[model samples]
Target: MKALVYEGARSVSVKNVPDARIERPTDVLVSVTTTNICGSDLHMYEGRAGMESGRILGHENMGEVVAIGEGVDKVRVGDMVCLPFNISCGFCRNCEAGKTAYCLTTNSDPLTAGAAYGFAGMGSHSGGQAELLNVPYGDHNCLVLPEEAQERQSDYVMLSDIFPTGWHATELAGLQPGESIVIYGAGPVGLMAALSAQLKSAAQVMVVDRHPDRLALAEEIGAIPIDDTLGSPIDQVNQLTNGAGADRGCECVGYQAHDPQGDEHPNLTLNNLVHSVRFTGGIGVVGIFLPQDPHSPDRLYREGEGEVAFDFGLHWFKGQTMGTGQCNVKAYNRLLCGLIEQGRAAPSWIVSHELPLEQAPQGYRHFDDREPGWTKVLLHPEESG
Candidate 1:
C-alpha cells in the first residue's frame, strides 16, 4: 500500500508502506475514503511538533468498514463510519465520565491521559492517511454512518474532529443563546466555531483574523469579521458589544498563533481573549499546546514547553473563568453527526481542496503556507476493494 510518509520539516512524500490491518480482536479495518489534513498536522509539518519520520499523518478520518474482528459485534463490514481522532478504550474512568479524549486506557504513557492518531506526544498509534487503517475498540471508537454518508464524505468526515472540536469550544465557553461571542482565529476550527455559535443562536458572532478569505467565509455565515490587519480586535469587539466586550471568547489558534504581520507569539490569542471577552465571561481554548520540546526552534516552545507571559492579573481582575485543552472529541461527535445527517449543519463549506492521496504532500505544502482558497484539504485514498 502507498501512504504519504513524513520526510522531515515541511517535506512529505508518497511512499509505499505496508498495509494497515486489524491488529486486535476488538479492532476494525477501514478502507479510508476521505481523510483530512488538519491544522494540527501543520504543527508537525512546520517542525514545531517533532514527529517521527515515516509516521502516517492523518487523524480526521471516515470510510467504509472493510473488515472487523470477531469480537467487534456491533460494527459490521460495509458500514460507513467516522473515527474520532481520540483513541479511547471506552471502559476507562475518563471514558465512563464522557471525557473520551482523556481515556486512561489508551495512552501508554502514564503522564498523558489522551492519545491520538498521527499526533506528537499523544501515542504511537499510526494514523489513517493510507489505503487501510486499523481501528481499535471498534464498537467504542467508530461512529457508524447512514447510507447518505457515501455521498457526503467531506461533511461526515469533519465529525471526526473540527466540527465537534468547535462545538466543544463553545461548550467550554458556556455560550448561551443570544449571548455575544468572539472567536480568535479564522481557520477551519474558528469558522466552525462561528457556525456553532450561529446554530446555538449567539446574539453576535465575531471572528478575528487577518485572512480575507477566512474572514469572508465567516461573514457569509452571519459572523461579524474583525480584520486584525485593520485595527485591534479588542476595540472591534468592544465597539460591536457597545464597549462591554463580547460575552465569551474562544481560542482556536493554540501555540502557533501569531499577529497579522506573521510574527509568531505563543500568547497572542490568549491575551487577546482575556482582554476581548466581557468581564467575568467564560473562555474556551481548543488549540493545541504541547509541553517543552528542547529541540524546538521557537524560543517559547524550547525545552519541551510553549510558555507565555500572559496577563493573568487582568484576567483575575475581570473575574473571568477559563477552560483549556484538547477537545475530548467523543463527548460531542455523535450529536454533531446527527446534525450533519439532518442537514442542520454543513461544515464542508470550509473544504477548499479535495485531492487524491498522491497529492497530499502538495496539499500539505500549500496549507502550511496558508495559500488562498486552501482552507481545508480532504484526501481520498484510492479504494482497495
Candidate 2:
C-alpha cells in the first residue's frame, strides 16, 4: 500500500508500505478514498511534536469499507464511512457519556485518555493517509455516510474532523442563537467555526486573523474580518461590539499562535480572547496546546508545566467561563451530516486543493508555509494508484 510517511522535521515521503488488514474481530478495513492534511499535523511536520519516523500521517479520513470483521454487525462491506479522528471503544465510561475524545479504554498509557490515528502521544494506531486503513472498533468509529456521500466526498470527509471540531468550539463557548461571537484564527478550523456560527444564526460573527486570504474567507461567510496585522484585535472586537466586547469567543489558534511579524507568543490568542469577549461571556478553546515544548525559546513555556501566561485575572474578574479539550466528534457528526444531506451545510467551501496521495508532501509544504490559496487540502489515496 502507498502511504504518506513522516520522515523528519518538515519532511515526508510517499512510499509503498505494508498492507493494512483487519487485525481484530471488531476491526474494519477501509479502502481510503479521501484524507486531509490537518493543521495539527504540522505540529509533527515542524518537529515541535515528537513523531517517530515511519508513522503514517493522517487523521481526517473517509472511505469505502472493503471488509468488516465478524464482530462488526452494524458496518458492512461497501459502506461509505467517515472515521472520526478519535478512536474509542463505545463501551468505555467516557464514550458512553458522549465524550469519546477522552475514552479511557483506547490509549494504553495511563497518562493520556485519548487515541487518534497517526497522532503523537495518542496511540499505536496507523493513520489513514494511505490506500488502506485498519479501523479498530469499526461499528463504533465508522460514521456511515448518506447516499450523496459519493458525490460530496469533499464535504462528507470533513465529518472526520474539522467540521465537528469547529462546531465543538461553538458548543464549548455556549453560543446562543442570535448572540454575537468572535473566533480567533481564520485557518480551516476557524473558517469552520465561522460556518458553525452562521448556521447557529449568530447575530454577529467576527473572525480575527492576520492572513488576508483567510480573513477573506471569513468575509465570504458574512463574518466581519478583523485583521490583527493592522491593529489590536481586542480593540477591533470592542469597537465592533460597541465596546461591550463579543458575547462569546473561541480560541482556534492554539499555543503556536504568533504575531503578524512571525514572533511566537503561546498565550497571545488566549489573552486576546479574554479581552475580546464580553464580561461574563463564555470562551471555548479547541486549539492544540502541548504539555511541553522542549524546543521553545521562552523559559516559561519550556518549564511552566504547559502554562503560558494569559489574562487569568481578567478572566476571573470578568467571571468568564471556559471549556477546553479536543472535540468529541461523534457527538456532532451525525447532525452535521444531516445538514449536509439536506443541502444546508457545505464545508467543502474551504477546500482549496485536491491532490493525489503522492502529492501530500507538496501539500504539506504549501500548507505549513501558509501559502496563499492553500486554505485546505484533501488528498485522494486511491487516485495515487
Candidate 3:
C-alpha cells in the first residue's frame, strides 16, 4: 500500500508500505476513500510535533469497511464510515463520562492530555491516509455513513474532525441563541466555529484573520470579517458590538497565533479572545497546543513542557469562563451527520483544494504556507474494492 509517510521537517511523500490488516479481535480493516491534509498534519510535517519517520500522516479520514473482526458488529463489509481522529477504548472511565478524547485506557501518559490517530504521544494506531487502515474498537469508533455518503464524501468526511471540533468550541464557550460571538482565526476550524455560531442563531458572528480569502469566506457565511492586517480586532469587535464586546469568544488559532506583524506569540490569540469578549462571557479554545515542540529550538515552552504566557489577570478580572482541549468528536458527529443529511449545515464549503494521494506533498506545501486562498485540502486515495 502507498501511504503518505512523514520524512522530516517540511517533507513527506507517497511511499509503498506494508498492507494494513485487522490486528485485533475488535479491529476492522477499511479501504480509505477520502482523507484530509489538516493544519494539525502541518504541525508534524514541519517537525513542530515530534512524529516518527515513516509514520502515516492523516487523521481526518473516511472510507468503506472491507473486513471486520468477529467481535465487530455495528458495521460490516461495504459500509461507508468516518473515523474520528480520537481513538478510545469505549469501556474506559473517561469514555463512560463522554470524555473520549482523554480516554484513560489509552495513551496513559500523564504528561500529555489525549489520544488520537496518527499523532505522536498518542497510541501506535496508524492513520487512514493510505489505501487501508486497521480500525480498533471498530464498532465504537467507526461512524457508519448514510447511503448517500459517496456523493457527499466531502461534507461527511468533515464529521471526523474539524466540523465537530468547531462545534465543540462553541459548546465550550456556552454559546446561546441570539448571543454575539467572535472567533479568532479564519482557518478551517475557525471558519467552522463561525458557522456553528450562526447555526446556534447568534445575533452577530465575527471572524478575525489576516487572510483575505478566508475573511471573504466568513462574510459569505454571514459572519462579519475582521481583518487583523487592517486594524485591531479588539477595537473592531468593540465597535461592532457597540463597545460591550462579544457575548462570547473563541480561540481557534492555538499556540501558533501571531501578532499583526506576523511575529509568533503563542498566547496572542487567547489574549485577543479575552479582550474581544464581554465581562462574564465565556471563551472556548480548540486550537492545538503542545507540551513540547520538536521544531522550536528556541525553547518557547521549556523543553517537554507546554506553557503559554496567558493573561490570567484579565481573564480573572473580567470574570470569564474558559474551556480548552481536543474535541470529543464522537459527542457531536452523529447529530452533525444528521444535519448534513438534512441539507442544513454544509461544512464542505471550507474545502479549497482537492488532490490525489500522490499530490499530497504539493497540498502540504500550499496548506503549510497557507498560500492565498488555500483554506483546506482534501486528498483521495485511489479507490479499492
Candidate 4:
C-alpha cells in the first residue's frame, strides 16, 4: 500500500508501505475512499509537533469496510463507514461518560489519556490516508452511513472530524438558538463553526480572519465577515451587537494564533474572545493548544508547558465560563449526520480541492501556504476521477 509519510519539517512523501491487515478480533479492514488534510496536521507538518518520520499522516477518514473481524457483529463487509478520529474503547469510564475524546484505553503511554490515528503522543494507530486501513474496536468506532454514502462521500467524510468539531465548539460555548456568536479563525474548523451556528439558528454569526478568501466564504453562508486587518475584531463585534458584544464566542485558532503581519501570539485569540464576548457569556475553544510548542515565539510555549500569559483577571471579572479540548466527535456526529441525511446541512461547501492520492504533496503545499482558493483539500485514496 502507498501511504503519506512524514519526511521532515515541511516535507512529506508518498511511498509503498506494508499492507494494512486486521490485527485483532474486534478489528475491521477498510478500503479507504476519502481522507482529509486537517489544520492540526499542520502542527506536525511544520515540525512543531514532534511527528516521527514514516508515520502515516491522516486522521479524518471514511471508507468501505472490506472485511470485518469475527468479533465485529454490527459492522459488515461492504458497509460505508466514517471512523471517529479518537480511537476509544467505548467501554472505558470516560467513554461511558460521553468523554470519548479522553478514552483511557487507547494511548499506549500511561501519561497520555487520549488517542487518535497518526497523531503524535496519541498512540500507535496508523492513519487512513492510504488504500487500506486497519481499524480496531470496529463495532464501536465505525459510524455506518446511509445508502447515499457513496454519492455524498465529500459531505459524509466530514463526519470523521471537522463537522463534529465545529458543532462541538458551539456546544462548548453554550450557544442558544436566538443568541449571536463570533468565531475566531476562518480556517476549515472555524468555517464549520460558522455553518453550525447558522444551522442552530443563531441570530447572528460573525467570522473573523485576515484572509479575504476565507472571509468571503463566510459571507457566502450569510455570516458577517469581520476582517481583523481592517480594524480591531473586538470593536467590530461590539459594533455589530450595539455595544454589548456577541452573546458568545468560539476560539478555533489554537496555539498558532497570529496577526496579519504573521507574528505568532499564542494567546491572541483567547484574549480576543474574552474581550469580544458579552460579559457573563460563554466561550468554547476547539482549537489545538499545546502545553508547549518548539516552534512558538513565546518562551513558555517553547518549554513544553504551553502556558501563555493572558488576562485571567478580565476572564474572572467578566464571569465567563469556558470549555476547551479536542472535540468529543462521537457526541455530535450522529445528530449532525441526521441533518445531512435530511438535506438540511452541507458541510462539504468548505471543501476547496479534491485530488487523487498521488497529488497529496501538492495539496499539502498549497494548503500549508493558505493559497487563495485552497481553503480545504480532500484526497481520494483510490484516485477516482
Candidate 5:
C-alpha cells in the first residue's frame, strides 16, 4: 500500500507501507477513494503535535467498504462510507451521553479520553491517507453515504471533520435563528462556520481574516468580511453590528493565531472574541488548543504550559458564556448528510485542489504554507482492487 508518511517537520513522502486489513471481528476494510489534508494535519506536519515518523497522515476519509468483519452487521462490502475522525466504541458512558469525541474506551492512555486516526497522542490507529484503511467498530464508525455519494465525494468527505466541527462551534455558541454572529479566522473550519451560520438563518454573518481568498469565500456566501490587516477586527465587527457588538462570536484560529507581521499570539482570537461579542452574549471555541507546545517560540506558551493570556476578567464582567472542546461529529453528520443529499449544502465549494495519492506531500506543503488558492486539498488513492 502507498501512504503519505510523516517524516519530520515540514516533511512528508509517499512510501510503500504494509497493507491494511481487518484486525478484529468488528472491523471493516475500506478501499480509500477520497481523503483530505486537514488543518489539524498541519499540527503534526510541523512537528508541534509530536507525531511519530512513518505514521500515515489523514483523518478526513471516505471510501468503498471492500471487506467487513463477521461482527459488522450494518455496514457491508461495497457500501460507500465516511469515517469520522474520532474512533469511538459506541458503548462508553460518554458515547451514551452524546459525547463521542471523549469516548472513554478508545484511547489506551488512562489520562486521555478520546482517540483519532493519524493524530498524535490520540491512538495507534493508522489513517486513511493510503490505498487501504482498517476501520474498527465498523457499524458504529462508518457513516454510510447516499446513492449519489460516488459522484459527490468532495462534499460528503467533509462530514468526516470540518463541516460538523464548524457546526459544533455554532451549537456551542448557542446561536439562535435571526441572531448575528462573527467568526474569527477564514480557514476551512472558519469558512464552514460562516456557511453554517447562513444555513441556520443568521440575520448577519461576519467573518474575520487577513486572507483575501478566504475572506472572499466567506463574502460569496453572504458573510461580511472583516479584514483585520486594514483595521481592528473588533471595530469592524462593531461597525457592522451598529456598535452593540455581535450577538455571538466563534474562535476558530486556535493557538496558531498571529498578527499581520506573522508573530504567534495564542491569545489573539480568544481575547478578540471576548470583546467582539456583545455583553451577555456567548462565545464558542472550536480551534485546536494543545495542552502544551514545546516548539512554540512564545515563552508563555512554552513555559506556562499552553496558557494563553485570555481576557477572562472581561469575559466575566461582560456576563458572557463559553463552550470549548472537540466536536461530537456523530451527533451532526447524519443531519448534515441529509442536507447534502437534498442539495441544500455544498461544502465542496471550499475545495481548491485534488491530487493523486503520490502528490499528497505537495498538497500538504502548499496548504501548510497558506499559499494563495490552496484553501483545501483532497487526495485520491489509486484503487488496488
Candidate 6:
C-alpha cells in the first residue's frame, strides 16, 4: 500500500508500505476513504513534534470497514465509519467517566497514561493516511457514519477530529447561550470553534487571525474578524466588548502560534487570549503544545515552537480559568454528528480543497504555508466504495 510517510523536518512522500490488517481480536480493518491533513499533522511535518521515519502521518480519518475480528460485533464489513483521533477502550475507568482522550487502557504508552495515533509521546499506532488502517478496540473507537455518509464525507470526516475538537474547546470554556466568545487562530479548528460558538447561540462571535482569507470566512459566518497582524487582538476585543473583553476566549492555535512578523511563538496566541476575554472569563486551549522540542533552534525549518512567555500575573489577577489539552474527540462527536445530520451545523464549510490521495504532498505544502484561501484540505484515498 502507498502511504504518506514522514521523512524528517518539513518532508513527506508517498511510498509503498506494508498492508494494514486486523492485528487483534478486537481490531477492525478499514479501507480508508477520506482522511485529513490537519494542523496537528504539521507539528510532526515541521519536526516540532517527533515521529519515527516511515510513520504514516494522518489521524483524522473516515472510511468503510473492510473486515472485523471475531470479537467485533458492533461494526462490520461495509459499514461507513469515522475513527476518532483518540483511540480508547470504552470499558476503561476513564472512558466510563467520559475522558476518552486519557483512556487508561488504550493510551498507556508503556510509561504513561494515554496515547494517540500519529503523535509523539503517544502510542505507536500507525495513522490512516494510507489505503487501509487497523483499528484497535474497533467497536468503541469507530463511530458509525450516518446513512448520508456518501453524500457528506466532507462534513462527516470532520467528526473524527477538528469538528469535535473545536466544539470541545468551546465547551471547556463554558460558553453559554447569549454569551460572547473570541477564538484565536483562523485555522480549521479555530473556524470550527467559531461555528460551534454560533451553534451555541453566542451573542457575539469573534475570531482572531493574521490571515485575511480565514478572517473573511469568519466574517461569512457572522463572526467579527480581528486581524492580529494589524494590531493587538486584545485591543480589538476590548473595543468590541466595551473594554470588559469577551465573555470567553478560545486558544485554538496551540503550539504553532506566531507573532506579527511570522516568528514561531506558541505563547503569543495564549497571551492574546488572556487579554481578549473578561475578568472572570474562562479560556479553552485546543491547540497542540509540547513540553520539549528536539528540533528547535537546530532544525532548519522548525515551525511554531519557542519559549511561551505567558502573562501569569494577568491570568492570576483576573481570576480567570483555563482548560487545555488534546480534545477527547469522542466526548463531543456524537452530539455534533447528530447536529450535522440535521443540517443545523455544516462544519464542512471550512474545507477549501479536496484531492485524490496522490496529491497529498502538494496539499501539505499549501496548507503548511497557509496559502491564501486554503483553510482545510481533505484527501480521499479511494473514490466512493
* TM-score, one value per model: 0.97, 0.99, 0.97, 0.99, 0.99, 0.95
Question: Compared with the true structure, what per-residue lDDT tens digits does model 3 show for residues 1-385?
Answer: 9898988889898889999998888999999999998878887888887889888888999999999998987789999999999988788778988888988766767664457778877866687789998888999999999999999999999999999999999999999999999999999999999989998899999999988999999999899999988888999999999999999999898777778776887778898888989999999999988878645433655454777777899999999999989999999999999999999999999898888898889999989888997899998997422
- Order candidates by lDDT, high to low: 2, 5, 4, 1, 3, 6
Error of 2 at 345 (Å): 0.3
lDDT of 6 by residue, 171-239 (tens): 889999999999998889999999999999999999988899899889998999999878878898899
Count of steric clashes across candidates, in order: 8, 0, 1, 3, 0, 2
State how far residue 23 of model 4 sits from its true place (Å). 0.4
After superposition, which runs of candidate 1 have C-alpha atoms over 4 Å from their true positions? 294-304, 383-385
Q: Model 2, range 1-385, lDDT digits (tens) per residue?
A: 9999999999999999999999899999999999999999999999988898999999999999999899999998999999999999999789999999999988989878999999998988899999999999999999999878998999999999999999999999999999999999999999999999999999999999988889889999899999988999999899999999999999999889999899898899999999989889999999999997887766788788678998899999999999999999999999999999999999999999999998999999999999999999999999985
- Provide the overall lDDT of each model, using Cα atoms, as 2-decimal numbers: 0.90, 0.94, 0.89, 0.92, 0.93, 0.86
Tens digit per residue, CA lDDT, model 1, 177-264? 9999999999999999999999999999999988889999999999999999899899988999899999999999988787777777
RMSD of 6: 2.6
Better of 2 and 5 by lDDT: 2
Clashing pairs in 3: 291-306
Q: Model 4: which ten-residue window has the lowest total lDDT? A: 291-300
For residues 22-140, write the lDDT of model 5, one tens digit per residue. 98999999999999999989989999988999899899999999999989999989999999999999999999998999989889998899999889988888998999999989999
- Any idea how many clashes model 2 has? 0
Q: Per-residue lDDT of 1-385 in model 4, one digit per residue for the tens?
A: 9888888988998889999999899999999999999999999999988888889999999999999898999999999999999999999999999999999999999888889989988998898888899998999999999999999999999999999999999999999999999999999999999999999999999999989999999999999999998889999999999999889999999998889788998889999999999899999999998875777888877885888888899999999999999888999899999999999999999888999888988899999998999999999998833
- Give the C-alpha lDDT of model 6: 0.86
**Clashing residue pairs, candidate 1?**
291-304, 291-305, 292-303, 292-304, 292-305, 293-304, 293-305, 294-304
Task: Give residue 132's lDDT in candidate 6 (0 to 100).
Answer: 92
Q: Which is better, 3 or 5, measured by TM-score?
A: 5
